[model samples]
Target: FKDATVWTSEEEGILVHTDVLIKNGKIAKIGKNLWAAGATIVNATGKHLTAGIIDEHTHIAALSINESGQNSSAEVKMEDVVDPEHIGIYRNLAGGVTSAQLLHGSANPIGGQSAILKLKWGANADELIYKNSPKFIKFALGENVKQSNWNSYSRFPQTRMGVEQTFINYFQRAKEYDLKKKNGEEYRHDEELETLAEIINGERFISCHSYVQSEINMLMKVAEKFDFKINTFTHILEGYKVADKMAAHGVGASTFSDWWAYKYEVNDAIPYNAAIMQSQGITVAINSDDAEMSRRLNQEAAKTVKYGGMTELEAWKMVTINPAKLLHIDERVGSIKEGKDADLVLWSANPLSVYAKAEKTLIDGAVYFDLEKDKQQREAIKKEKALLINLMLQEKDKGSPTQEPKKKDQEQLHCDSL
Candidate 1:
């Protein structure tokens, strides 16, 4: 990319009229007037270049967002249900989102494990996921976990306090299971307990769905008892109430910008949630729990500036570096710097502005979404569809055998949609 206004998502600040070079799928250099031999140059004049948006919480690529067969579904993995061909992948690419955490839904107290994706279009499931991916599991609190929407009167944890007991009971069982396994005692392998054991051993992290402050504090206390910290609290609408405690406990907060009153417990949610958490020294990230909202995270990040007076750079971090930090993938992405993966987006204007649109989005130095290429693809698809329909009509005139038409359903799910 040549002669663009670069926001490095680092302390180096914005570099105007800067040139960036990508080689071997990594950022080669950033300087004034850079040139590369045998390279396809992108004319980035009058454009803004920044690291690709990292959605800390999303459910775009997965087939099933929840595993609610039991109170704890830690054994299930979201990677198993990943739909790489989902249009959301291409849509997210067009929106400048290069990576995302495809987390499980908030159906159970202990939701299924998560999948980390790079948003690589047309790739297979295994290729879409990162190699040696960090392990993460989803946990939940509040109404969803307690069967508020399901109307299940027989559910075990039908109240808020039972939610806390669910965590304690599982963690205690996992502790005993780990101790017995460590002692070399031969026992049957249990996938569910094994996952909980990983959490107890700090081998896997937890991204919890939270709302009220009391449950947030409850889980933190339980984690402290087990000697582990919660990695992130996604949809933590009421995080501002316990920002200091969260900062002290060293848990990251990934929250919405101004989502409120959608539910009863989230009444305390405020637009200043992210800013307040950041001010208290907590790593804060802006998240999109919905598919459409995920496409315009820049606008969500910009909300912090309007509501709580965060700087543009700080607001940008809420979508970029801060999410990278929460996902533990900052070393490889989330910034424009030498020796990092070249996950970048070229925007038409200031990325924090509502009018800004992604002209080009790249992952690992490969262009995944371009305005011109997208137009070409749309035209080609139209032509192909016309040809196919013509052929089908000819077949129908020839009295060819056919089955009844069936409508396929493509359900769009979010953290609590199920």
Candidate 2:
């Protein structure tokens, strides 16, 4: 039962006093005060129950966010490098996050692949993956790759043209590599280019890091030349200029809420970027490139109202459905509908409010986080730690040191005394 504000997929929005029945990790039924036999019911009466928030772009849980040693480093996978116990995962879940696209950093021209992850707290890495998630590559543009922040004296692709060329060069190599592999040419294995070749063959999609109009157009041309589409552009600060082109190219754009002026290339970024892109029929999503912004994703969606006058539901879609669509996991996790995995959150007040708190978070029919349980867990952890520390100190005061290591050292010394 989604207790707070229940948002059902039906035309009616935020049904009050609703009872939702969940069975076998799927919503069985929804009605006001509905009774079900043998079903575990959740009383989410004062919570805002809706689809779990999806963070379209983030670097949380990565061993390293960047692989900048080479221009193209697509061999690396975020899954292989995830740190499941990152505090950010728990924090995001507390903010109603259920899934995230853990992306590689934009330190290189062609970065590694991104992994779509469900925020299954307390689960191992394998259990956290969204089953059958689509494959995606990370292609970066503008200052991050050009080394504009640092001295560009020794870096490859120092100019915008060089960045475009780097992309093109890689695609060309990938195309040939793919052709050889397909024809059974028995060529030496190259992991990096193997991933690029997947993009060339339309087996994987590209999510580019973009800013500035010229570079945006350049990346699109490179994608077109390689006979594959650029799926989405993350942080497309100059997207307003090429919104129509992005729409025509069938490329989605995931962008910041109102970020600007953090760098020289992003000086022209306007708050209405999302609205402008959406106006041109481009599928747009608001993302948290920063860790802190990810928690209050509802507020990020609200910025569209101030900037472009988007409806509340439309704005909410930017953080929910649109991101799920871009990640190609829409069918499973984006909305509160019957038959979808029951990944949802219940909030204490209007989710967009700064004061709102997620009362409960559920994933795959299991209550993963409950506010009250979390509070108790925190207190228990503190008490346990304090007790353990005191016990260690007591042993120390009694002159009973950790004896295993010392015993080993003494035994070695005694043997040497022979």
Candidate 3:
């Protein structure tokens, strides 16, 4: 049990100075200075506790983010290629991220499906999965998919129209594939299109990589024609221009903070994309496409205040509730509420400040990161590993047959795979 000034990510300016009780890894209760006689209590009098941040789009665990061999390669699953020991997960947990949607990159017109991972620090890859999480696919547009500015040998999708046709062709093939599978046709297995058929049947949602308004509108129409929806448009640099259309399509936007002009297609990218999308009643989320950017999501949310005059709470929602809703995991997380998973972060100061730090990060009522303890643990691990390695080398010098060194592959599911 712990007592803190909780910021539930509910109503604006609403902070509850209460005790949060945890039992069996779930939030047991939240009330005013409550007591539990035999339970351990940690006083959080000055810290601000809020739900752990969720990264809507990330590619941290995969061995390769881009499967650009073909334009529409939906057969691959990010889960199959997850590198459970990626050090990036630990860094993200230190930054207060508890959940992340590990997405495929925007290299193909229709990329692969994404994996919703829970940052269970020190857990195995299978354990990191958010069980029963909603399914989503990655589709891409603009220069990345079109290969307009990049000198690449990839075939097809070299133009905007080609990109749209690539998506249409994949869906059309997927629809027929679904019918064939339903009818028990002996179709030679094609893993790529099999995943796309799921999307056409509304089994999986789409998170597109888009920029220009033309491609944005095109993808929406394609989804509309198929009677399926593009769930969210990631890195929608030009989303401000088509906020109304996106709102009508019920598509959310996850974009970077003031990142623009890196490519010719992003000439019109604006810092106010998130705010404009919100103004049009379209769900908007500020995302960190880069590793460093994710650590300061609070500041990314603050950008809405500077560029679009959005209220602080609204900006906060862009990172918290709005992202959870978009990912279809709102019921379990994204807010510090009773009966929800006890995934929370305690901030030392106003989280929006550049200097703010995550004092502690908890997932399922277990402390995943403690800055001071991490430093100590790291040093201990370094010493132990050095000692063991030295012993192994000495044994090898003595020509001991039993001293054959173990390979890296034998490190069974170590933690920090978060």
Candidate 4:
């Protein structure tokens, strides 16, 4: 990218009139008038360039987000059900998102393992994964796990206190399983226990779906009892009330920009929650759990500036380096620094502005989304849809059977879904 205004999202911050050189899918250089022999130059004059935006939390690319038959489902994985053709992947790339944490649903206390993916649109499922990314498990607390929204109470842990005991009981069993295995005692191999043992041994990290200060404190205490730490608290809308405690526990927070009051537990959620957590020495990242919101995470970061008086650079970091640090992928794709993956976006204006559009998005030095190309594709899609509709009308005129058009499924399942 030549002669672009760059937001490096590094300690040095923004650089003006810079040129970034990409070679073999990594940022090879960043300086003025940078040139390479036989390199394909992208003339980005007067454009804005930055590291690709990261969505720390999302449920895209998965066919099924939950295996709700059991409360403890650590055996399932998001990668196992990934759908490479999901349109959300391309849409997110158009909004400059290059990578995301594809999470499992919060239908139970212990959910499935997560998949961290690069927005390599049109690639196969395995090719889209961020290879060797840190292992992360999903844990849900509060109403969702307790079945507060359910009409029946057949499941275990139907109350807040019961939820705490469920975790304690599971961890205790997992500890025993680990101890026996370590001692070389004969034991049955249980996938669920194996996953929990990894947490005890610090082999896996937790990104918990949480709300309400009391339950948050309870989970941390439970983690302390089990001799493990929570890596992050996703959807921690009420994080402000427990900022000091979360900081003390060394858990990062991945939360919505300013979401609140969608449920009873989040009544006290404030727009300043992210800033409050950051001020208390907790690493905070703004995450979009919704697929549509996942596309425009830059606007989500901008909200921090309005609510917390955070500088634009600091706000941008919340969606970039801060999330990278939380997900343990900072070394790979968070900033436009030398030796990092060339996952970047060329924007028409400052990314913080609502009018800004992602002109070009690249992942690993490959163009995944281009505005001009997208325009052409949209026209083609319109023609295809029109042709299909005309055929359907012809069939109707011939008195053949016809059915209503299928609606796109936009149903979102949160922690409280029954």
Best by lDDT: 1
The residue-by-residue lDDT of candidate 2 on 214-246, one tens digit each, is 998888888888788988999998899889998
Candidate rank order under lDDT = 1, 4, 2, 3
TM agreement with the true structure for every prediction: 0.95, 0.89, 0.88, 0.95
10 residues in a row with least lDDT, candidate 4? 409-418
lDDT accuracy of residue 313 in candidate 3: 72
Residue 284, model 3: Cα distance from true site in angstroms: 1.1
lDDT of 1 by residue, 1-418 (tens): 8999999999998999999999999999999878778988988899999999999899998888988778999999999999998999999998899999999999999999889999999899999898788899999999999999879777789999999999999999999999999999987899999999999998999999999999999999999999999999989998999999999999999999999999899888889899999999999999998899999999999999999999999999999999999999999999999999999999999998888989999999999999888999899999999999899889999999766868998899887666
Each candidate: how many clashes? 0, 8, 4, 0
- How many clashes show up in model 4? 0
lDDT of 3 by residue, 1-418 (tens): 3556676777634465677787767788877867766777777776777788888877666676777787776887888877777777888888888888888887788887889988886788888988997988888887777665557756896888888788788789888888888999878777877788777887888888788898899999999998888899988989999899999988999987799987688889989888888899888888876666666788888788898998867777778778898899999988877788988888886666677788889898899898889889999999999999899789879997663556774222210111
What residue runs in model 4 are displaced by over 4 Å at the alpha carbon? 384-418
**lDDT value for model 4:** 0.91
lDDT of 3: 0.80
Regions of candidate 1 where Cα sits further than 4 Å from its true position: 386-407
